[model samples]
Target chain A: MPTDPKNPSGASTINGTDAVDSRRKPGAAEKSWEEKTLVPTLAKSPERASKFTTVSSYPIRRLYTPADLSGWDEDRDLGLPGEPPYTRGIHPTMYRTRLWTMRQFAGFGTAEDTNQRFRYLLAQGQTGLSVAFDLPTLMGYDSDHALSEGEVGKCGVAISSLADMEVLFDKIPIADVSTSMTINSPAAVIWAMYLAVAEKQGADWKKIAGTLQNDILKEYIAQKEYIYPPEPSMRLVIDTIEFGAKHTPKFNVISISGYHIREAGSTAIQELAFTLRDGIEYVDWALRRGMNIDEFAPRLSFFFNAHSDFFEEIAKYRAARRIWHKTMTERYGAKNARSWALRFHTQTAGCSLTAQQPYNNVVRTALQALAAVLGGTQSLHTNSLDEAWALPTEFAATLALRTQQIIAHESGVTNTVDPLGGSYFVEALTNEVEAGAWDYIRKIDALGGMVAAIERGYPQREIADAAYQYQMEVDRKEKIVVGVNDYFTKENPLDILQIDESVAHRQAERLAKLRAERSSDEVARRLDGLRIASQGKENLMPYIYDAVKAYATLGEICDAMKVAFGIYDEVAIT
Target chain B: MSEKRIRVLIAKPGLDGHDRGAKIIARALRDAGMEVIYTGLRQTPEMIASAAAQEDVDVIGLSILSGAHNTLGPRLMELLREKGMGDVCVVIGGIIPEADIPALKKVGIAEIFLPGTPTQAIVDFIRSRISAAPSKA
Candidate 1:
């Protein structure tokens, strides 16, 4: 017990011997309780397991109390919502004012086919759109390319040129809907096609809003969809940041992502550390390109994965905001408060889904989505139940969307802002996660930032090790994943959505028709200009836009740049 | 007499970059006292067949997650036979649906491992299968 002058009731005053001095510290109280009460109970009946840990295998304590947060300063560590450090929340009135945008990542088959799915999702109350390009498009290949076999539209929509992009958006008004494209390697070329579509729709460039997953650093570290080497890829990213700052004022040029990194098997702390470090690396590059921090930093958004472990996920997001705030204002000298605030879109962890007992994934996804909402995400994409089997079917996708809707409309958790802000466990865990991430940042800084560290295979090795350890833990039954390792049951396989082989044939035919109709001379001249520009220090977005306007294929534009910047081959490590 | 250790060549065919499973399998195989060579991401069928031949591996572990297994799987088998390495133990692991597993086996994929499979199970499967067959070496 401790006496507090602020307590008018004198509740803390146990005796009249200098009230405050007569009380024991919380640590002493906890120690006494554990010895007298906990030891006797534990001796009588043993606990269920010898040890407990989070999904990441981090140790979990028996309980969290004020003793855990000895160094926490309320006003300094966590201020009011919509204020500095942003640990509580970004806005003062978080979801009470407006709910997060429900953006389901949907794509599979030709542009026409995926367009139907997009319209269906929008009709079902999806507030935003996220395009999932097929493997060929993600790898910068046309549907007719030799490497595109059996993969034309299996994973996502096949967009070969601006013609395909136009059909993808079809009747959708570009100015009204905010779109997010999950493209990485050929992000510049694909973004040009998107801008070309918006231009044709008479949408003003400055008014258009969306996010381009233009994070190439994470590609090398985790996703492995990289085309050009790190040096040239970074140049392309900085070019987009510069161009977007000057032109598309509302669009986020780069969504520095930890989603793929986590999906590739990283701990939550690793995801937080590497993603923010990737953001720092981009800011450094943009500064070298002669751009002010406030100019482009405001448009730099982030994407994270809302995995299981509810408290850990929530703490990760809180720590992310606080770390970003400190880095922007103190480290980079950003003057704009908008630049200091870290806004992110979260998707339920796809790696957490199970192929066996597929219906159980619905429950997992709902819980993960709830975690994203509680973590103060700006936008959320709930993964479908059948994703582990294949791309989501219409029924499954709708159920995933409904999960988010239930949380927003039915769950009472959204009525208040940062409801878990004052919890002892959450606040302490936020500080601990932040400290773990700072250690990684310091290590990466010693390795000369993320790019150099990636080239050295530091982060990749760390993630691989973490992944292997987690798998081993699951194998040894140390971690119990329901319906996976334990609680075993045999069930019929779910009916998954399949892409017909004719999709490849149809996409090839469309590419041929476009080639035959478009101007060959204009395509060649524009490609020649792009090739020349790639060898120089000029901004390549305009050159790519010109090539896209002339109906040059995605593969052709990427090939033009490949002529100047050779392909990068990473050394495989196990 | 010293026993010959199994040699595994883990290759990622096609353009998909989901290599978490592949890398984990490679490490597991190595930990089980086998020599492993991983052909990194974006490797085509021809590249994989050539790497398997060059590395002189006894088993070719193909990881395809882009649903291109129906095409890439058969194509790699043909390439291996053309390279006179038809006796190689060809195994595929990824998000292979149950309905497609039979067709994959028909195309000469010895085994298909889906998600949530234990690494020990994979290790045991490889050992039992490889020892049952004649050693190509």
Candidate 2:
């Protein structure tokens, strides 16, 4: 048995001596059964497959028994709900008290167009709002910029400035909804615009709640919408964390995400390890900024990908909760119970959705979402069937939302908390997953942290290698993707949502009008103030708010910061 | 005279950073024993065309997941023609709607590979197509 460095006490050893004495000796009984019954059956009819594995390529054993968790202490490892280690669930009455928030990510074309979709989703019983900005908006470019050509509103909604943001939230009660914006490097500027909109709506800053997908470390590692270098980008994230802690106390300043990491083709272990390490990196930065751990740590939420592989995905979540609790309490010495809890939102894996037989994706999403629910996600997003082609159409998005509804209302899985908490397979798999993650965390720590590791292209290279290996597996028929590798059929293409070319023209015209009408002098002065603040040691939130309020475009504000903190060019490795 | 090895340039052109397909294709082509150069992310049509010319590659693979392929694909072909490098074999991939495929091909895209296409198929297509053309060298 390999020893775990994190469990230096050898407490996790599977010696079978620590097991309760009342039960039969599981190890010996298993061997006896294999020799007498199983061997004969196998001789008569051999096992079907050569090897069984999870989607991550981790081997799956035939059966798990008490021997698999020999030295395990149930109370120590799987704590009570709402208690330390949060191995079961965060709240005592998990989904019985409140069902997981069904927040389908929706954004495409202009802000007005997306606003209609947002209203439609809310009317259809969506509990929260999650915005997906288009490429131009995500990359901190205006709709009229040269680089923004043909990309104004293709992938998501185009929000160029405060004006667009206001329209996006028009007629919607911003103070009531918990909005989550998926923006990275330009997250600060976009968040400032959002706060400005809330302020214009006469909403109290402290009362408003939302989350910013402001984890820039993952941008360098996985999602590549990054605008600045690691150091400056981290400064912006920390600034938001510090600002949110003091002012917007109800808001999640950053959703330190493993969603993109998994979508970028990482194993479940890598996703959990890197995401938790990223949380550690942020806490380290915030502490370096002279903040207490309990102050901002409570609001630091997580986002994970709910891929296929029912047991592995569940084990991953359980391990994520345990590992985070241990890290916060043991490593950071966090005192508050809320600070130790790992609250996460999960999105069904988009990469797993198949283009051929797109309708099969509905079943795939239902299973993935069910796993997320059973694993105790606080919120969830189910990918639409047509997402492999384009941004989901209205009918598809509504159907995706209904998938969550069916799981919550019709599915009986939510009646109990941590329903699979103590299964022999689940418990053993959770421990194994946690051990694997700890090994990776130690490796990343040896590399000086995630930023240093990313700078050396460590995680990048690992993910690329895993991605290549998975493709090779699929190609060789070693692993089968239902619609792609097996069950092949000619596909009749479904009608996909298309962002009209006129979206670019309309956005450009709106931008031109905004530029012509707004005070360019005020914009320039606020941008200059922001540029100066970017150079200094001041938290950039206030300066960004000032620029955003002055009607400065996203590109203008990001440009001002870019002048101080130059652009980052990644060392692309394949 | 010794036969020249196939040279390919795999470029990610657009603001979006969905490079999983691009990098996989690049590695696949390289494993197929062809020389491959990846231009990383956020390259414009002009930059991709210029890189293809500068590298003197025979095949160019453009990966655009941002839905900007309709614009970037044609402009890239236009630039290649302007630079008298129109003989280059260009293929596009990633999240392309079926309705856009014929138009892209009309604009000189040799082929379009949507998601779920095996790397071997991409490799085979590039190999067969490039070998069929006369040596530019």
Candidate 3:
């Protein structure tokens, strides 16, 4: 007989076979409650829908109790903060000792213009610097390149050479502040620019603390700002990891990011699984490159997105730490405790912001920021209200900074570590996220690894399906996005930031002047040296460092490498 | 009556990779019985214009989120006009600021779709704007 999903095992068979049979069957009390209370209540007032689910489409149980986490062991599953399997948090005193770094990702217009914004945010109590490069800079092109037209200093500041990087941090001391650069594909080259600038500032590499978002896998997976194929790209990432482990003890080489993955319309669980799996791929490649896991793994940091789901987002961060801890110890044989801890930066979900009723975005951002804080994020970036319309205007960016400030100073959430640790619902959800992510890992492992899985379009297809499913839900009114799907409004237009048209002209002129003044022969020699070094087994960071120091523009160096390692064209699966 | 599908070229004209809006509109237009060509990301005005000309698209839809609309918007229009494709309907989408609307419209863009504009509204606009015999060549 075919299995009837509703009543697969007969009522008679549910009574006395084994523990499994008894567990599947509702208890006598639950059955009585369902028959009497639930049925009558439903008949009188029908439930809103046949089923309810989280934003990620995970089913939401009506109520959770200790029974939901029946087999969960406190020691094994929910160890104390700063311990192995740190589901509670990575640090013993997560926020009591020091709060998360208030980092606002701000970069637009010229280097001088963005430098001013940096000073303003720093004066307004922003703790860290996160650089957002313009399109040309992000894709390894000079400001004057044909592809860089109309895009110079539009999205983020355009930094084409060490000179621009130096101007970007004019008065800001690299020694005192931790900076995060959101650039990949050409991350190795861009990071070299930053290092050269720091060297000019007389800052020691070991003492300079910062993070480089050198996660090219995510670029191929979501961001699509890639210049080279995955193989050579992975080589560049490993080179940085090896270089950082040896030299820059304080700097985090790769911020394994799921922020863009979630922004590209992945479920929360997909974001978690794919991000950790990417981290695993990086670790495996590094080990293959002859680096010890403990040497590089401890410095590896993560970046995640804090979406609108409050409890779910909190559980994701907690579960990520736990999963990373277990994977490092059991799977990779990492002996150092710090190597097991997953330190991460969280940014409020830019995807969740609605262009309608733009003011409502402030509330949404506050809630998401609170979720990041409650989840024990090491650093945070709150999106501004006007972000969905344009890059945040100065006023809007200030308010976004204030969101993080209010959470840190005003809110009493920082008084305890893992304040929601004992809640049955939170604990249960944490385990569920871990279990779900492990299932994805197993599938990826079966396909050989993440690279093999990516080649076959596994995660990409999963995210696209999830995105389509969500849009359908919103269209069918199954899900409610305030001010978007429901609670409609005619948004009174807000003041938006407009990049000046002269930025491109000014940037091109600067590049032209630099090209005239710099030693062309030195640039050519450095680039050729970089090209030859890129083809060999030796690390390319030293060559990139030399090239940047010689004032070779980003495009020049990247084109040189392109000669050795050809450009990447994405396999279109959509 | 046999109707040729509305061939629309959708191009991302800047470095911003937030394609949720682009992908959504592409699918919506495809469902609405239009042939949409999606140029993935980081396309220059030159590349976009070249693609539009080669594809012989009746409509060119540009998506820009980087606030470079003032610079790129007019550049694309001029490039398209230079390519002798000025008759093609041009629609602009993504985080376009209100202050820049007059300038973009002044440059001959036929429509501007803000973030909240419905996908159906876009489909209807494209269908209504194109002439009866949209140049199939």
Best by lDDT: 1
Using DockQ as the measure, what is the rank order of every candidate, best first? 2, 1, 3
Query: What tens-digit string does per-residue lDDT give for candidate 2 at A161-199?
Result: 999999999998988999999999999999999999999
Stretch of 10 with least lDDT, candidate 3 chain A:
A10-19
lDDT values for all models: 0.91, 0.90, 0.86
TM-score of structure candidate 1: 0.96
Go through the candidates in order and give each one's DockQ: 0.80, 0.81, 0.50
Tell me the lDDT of model 1 at A45: 57
> Please, what are the lDDT tens digits per residue for candidate 3 over residues A342-405?
9999999998898888999999999999999989899999999998888899999999999888
Off-target runs (Cα >4 Å) in candidate 1 are A1-25
Docking class of 1: medium
Best by DockQ: 2
CA displacement after TM-score superposition, residue B59 of candidate 2 (Å): 0.6
Worst 10 residues of 2 chain B by lDDT: B1-10
lDDT: worst 10-residue window of model 1 chain A? A11-20
Candidate that beats the other on DockQ, 2 or 3, i.e. the better one: 2
Better of 2 and 3 by lDDT: 2
